[model samples]
Target: MADERLIAALDFHTMEDVQKLVAELGDSVSYYKVGMELFYSVGAPVVTWLRQQGKDVFLDLKLHDIPNTAAGGICSLMRLGATMLNVHASGGYTMMKTAVDRMHAEADKMGIKCPKLIAVTVLTSINQEDWEGLGQAIQIKSAVVRYAKLAKKAGLDGVVASAQEAALIREACGDDFLIVTPGIRPAGSDTNDQSRVVTPAEALSNGASHLVVGRPIYAADNPVLAAENIIKEMENVK
Candidate 1:
């Protein structure tokens, strides 16, 4: 059951690869993430195909631009029917709020279900040094709390965080607020570029509403079995 929260990252190079991976993963995963690389390469067709399959999608574009332009992007992508989408919290309050407001207006005008709008607080790739290098005075946890608060104020549904920070976010943002965490690594897997990694169960236990896993599943010897094992692992967290 916890497997339902697992969002498979379709970071593949081609649609053929995505279809093969999806076939391998099957109904075991109901959600997928389409980031810049894949989306730019194939455009909206992958989103179209995923919608056709009745799969929920997380459009991880991390849009960051002027208020009007970002809002325009959000509205355009929501029309593609992704169930979840995001903007960069670093984009500042006006940009994030404008995206939320205008997208809501567009959705209302079209009478379509509004997609979940989340914000990326801090990428799992960076650590404290990286944060400081970005010329920020605050530490990682403090910055995440601040950004998460700002995103919420901008009317976002959730924030993209690391499982390691899920508890802090839950404490700061409350239970009703969602925290969709990436950088999930099962036991004995490579950490890749993620600096704040946690197991799926650990993420769940720490108040992550959803988990996003990519390489751990896609790069395994048997992807389908790997997904099943990850689900089993997530179930065992409690």
Candidate 2:
């Protein structure tokens, strides 16, 4: 189902909030992104709990560190059985490559399937102005594409980018490479803190393999309907 492509983000601070949202959303959403806030708040059991519920988890820790440390962290998280894991693309090729290699080795050792490894190209919260303010010479889109290229070279399965840059990433990395786009606001939903937001249909049409939606789904009065509507929008594009 196209609904599987929609990843509901568990952005809550506690397990009670997470459980409530997940129960409310129910079968409309099969994939979930457990980002740092919820992850740090609840820890590894959250991933295990989501797994127990038969939902896929995208562990969005955005690991960024020295090659050995990053690799070690990924290897540790591997035991949690997350469906996907990501590192910062800015961590450099060696770091990304080392994480990928070690992740595979660990999976083989444990006789479990290795999670898809992706790199975070850029956070959707940063706009062109914010990027320039950080003294970045390259334009935001260009930098994102450059990072996507580097991520692919590092043997990553994909890069987390905005849908605005998804087509470019798809073109540069090819159709098979994953382009998981966050900052997805369905139609007229508030943009919230994210700077580069797109509607669910626009994101899928723009070549995003998956959409991570948080506020729009979790905050809606009827979360199940909200998620179903977004999934409908996603399917209609095909």
Candidate 3:
């Protein structure tokens, strides 16, 4: 159950904040995600620090570029010792395949386990209206399915999608393909900037492999208690 319940987003602005959160969460959660903000602030040093503390890290840089460029970037990320990493699915098949293959090759060369490569299908911050305005004719659900299929064909391990799309992605890509869900808000919590949101229990019951929680835990009055509550909710669902 602990394996499925959590992937706490370390969305801090400084290394100090990250250290505080790690201390607060302790072994209650084993996985931590370092997104762009924290990564930019502390760089690869943070990944080294997290490993020293025995936590598995997910580097969420969401690399997107030409195939060669994206492959180079993923190789560098693999050297940083990421357990998982993400690329933009919209970067297209060649770019996604390049990133995955390069990372695997580099890991093999270095005698380390290859990081699980996942693609970001759609950000949780956007909605159907936003997609329509951006020239997408299909609804959000259909669009997510489209990208999930594309990612699988491109040799990606899975995708980062909102929990609302988890069931459909599983249907389209099969049960083994990973779905790392973000935009999770516990029941009755403020939605903040996230538009596609679900409770941890809903995400788990709906077939999410991981729940990426940020504000609800980081901004809570008592963060440790907040994390424990989320773990409890996930246990109930399991």
Q: Please list the residue runs of candidate 1 whose C-alpha ends up more than 4 Å from where it truly belongs after superposition.
A: none
| Candidate 3 local Cα displacement, residue 33, angstroms | 0.8
State TM-scores per candidate.
0.97, 0.98, 0.97
lDDT of 3 by residue, 8-87 (tens): 99998799999999998887878999999999988999999998998899899999999999999999988888789999
Model 2: residue 85 alpha-carbon error in angstroms: 0.6
User: Distance from true position, residue 112, model 1, in Å?
Assistant: 0.7
Model 2 over residues 111-163: C-alpha lDDT tens digits? 99999999999899998889999999999999999999999998999999999
Alpha-carbon lDDT of model 1: 0.91
Q: Which candidate leads the pack in lDDT?
A: 2
The collision pairs in model 1 are none
RMSD of 2: 0.9
| Top TM-score hit | 2
Which has the better lDDT: candidate 2, or candidate 3? 2
